[model samples]
Target chain A: MTNVSAELDSRFRAAAAEEGLLDVAYDVVDSPLGELFVGISDRGLCVISYEADPDAQVERLARGFGSRVLRSTRPVDPARRQLDEYFEGKRKRFDLDVDLRLARDFGRTVLEELGRVPFGEVTTYGELAARAGKPRAARAVGTIMNRNPVPIVLPCHRVVGANGSLVGYAGGLERKHQLLRLEGALLA
Target chain B: MEPVRIPPFETFYEEHKDPVFAHLRRLLGQGAEDAFQETFLRALRAYPELRNGRHLRAWVFTIATRVAIDETRRRRPMASPWLHELAVEDGLPPHAELGHLTDNLPPKERAAVVLRYGFDLPYDEIAAALGSSEDAARQATSSGVRRLRERSKRS
Candidate 1:
């Protein structure tokens, strides 16, 4: 069996990108938290999950986007850079374009509002719900945070409970705490 | 009933890329690289809609065969009348390289012979790859082998 040479593999990726056949391009980047599986579509950066099984992450991307997902780092380079800056506390706000296609309707709305919560600020879930134009949807907003597809980019970690306690982070509350502390929203 | 689990395209591509490349190399030789890229690009474009993973090997091979045929026809617009005559009567030239010999066969026969002998795919799978009935695939393989054997005898 002839092994695919790196040159040929890169050529295939370039051709696929030119033909618009690469629907989702992803890469794994090292971060202060851990390895992040970053997935980007032509629209923008879409998935930013804490490292788990790489195969499982790719499968989820295939299910959400088209199955034309590939491991091309160039498409994800900007996100990686920004994430690195954020973890190092050198960047105050993410200037990167985020693809929220994985989240929809109210979840999309809440996440969008969450992005504007600033780098060193914290907001209650009820405040986020009100900003999303549904004050009664605080519980629903919490659920959306639990399923935030692009968490760090969307600032899901800045959200807290009404009692000012860290709660309902899908990546675990400890990660949420660490993120908040990194942004100086919580004391280190 | 449990739903069929279609593997991610990455997994699917990894599993089939080398074999598909080998099949295309047999059929298209130097042009296999381009045809191999086309086959996988086409596969990736249609991967999300695929509901069944059971026939993925056949599916990819089918794509590779079509790509090879298209590449061949593009290069030689009109089929060479002499090649057809040789296939029907005296067989291909004995000294011809295996790639050149197979390249001169009719598209279906070339695909059948490559899929069956080169890859050792079962006849039913060959039928799927060639998009023909199993009996037809069997007949094509036998005919293709006979032509190659006849050429060998003449040498």
Candidate 2:
């Protein structure tokens, strides 16, 4: 094994990396925006990504699972199953246990508020923060989203800037634009 | 005043159901379905004392953990079938790998590690739940992590 792999493996095991393996046993899928990274955990469905950077993905996984990831043969896996239904517009509510471990206080509050944004609709950061009972925390909410533990799963793309300005997204503005278009939120 | 009976047991079950079920599911894995039913059965027997909702979730977890441990001990010397399934699903070799990490650790250490990983609990909460000093809880997690790394390295 490569030295980096060995080091990564050892660090992961030291994190007591069980339980999450089942959750991370997932497969990527082709989406309108780009390749999607969806993984599950024993607690429930976890990360749904749109980026291609392995390091960022690994760091997110490690924060939740220490370093454990699993693969499954069934292409129609739990994570994929629910997510496919979500994008197909068949499922509105998610039945997954989200791991918001990397989020805290304001970040956590922001994500929780995002969950209430409702499907097939969009909301601005200031509106979301107001719902979180901290209207001035809008900018803080935007910063919180820069490191959202579960991006697409938490629907960070659904958040727009004031007056519907397509704001910055860790997964790139293109994917954000595509997602907004897919949800029919982008204006003519 | 004679202790007044609460409404139907369903009320308590309805209140604490999901969190209790989720807790047991993490603790015992797939075996939680059965253990959950057993927990409520035992709870029914002691319904009067379960009135306090302040720690209801933790209380349910404690009882469920005890029951799971008992069932686990009762079936010792034989690989736990449920654990075997979990190991296989997690991509670990079956047979000897089922409890390779867990069976070797002490119960407190195992519970501490399980709670920490399963629920993402911090050291202090784990110590409180396991009735140990914060230092002891941290030690248990540290040692447990070390042993897991060592065993996985050999594999």
Give lDDT per model, in order. Answer: 0.79, 0.62
TM-scores for candidates 1 onward, in order:
0.77, 0.46
Candidate 1, residue B116: the lDDT equals 63
TM-score of each model's B chain?
0.60, 0.48
Which residue pairs show backbone clashes in model 2? A23-A40, A23-A41
Candidate 2 regions with alpha-carbon error over 4 angstroms: A1-23, A53-56, A73-76, B1-155
Query: Which clashing pairs does model 1 show?
Result: none
DockQ of predicted model 1: 0.50
lDDT of 1 at B149: 74
Relative to the unseen true structure, what is the C-alpha lDDT of residue B14 in candidate 2, on a scale of 0 to 100? 49
Deviation from native of the Cα of residue A180 in model 2, angstroms: 2.2
lDDT of 1 by residue, B60-149 (tens): 888887777678667765552224434444454533245566777887887787666544567886886776789999999889878777
How close is each model in CA RMSD to the real structure? 5.7, 18.5
lDDT of predicted model 1? 0.79
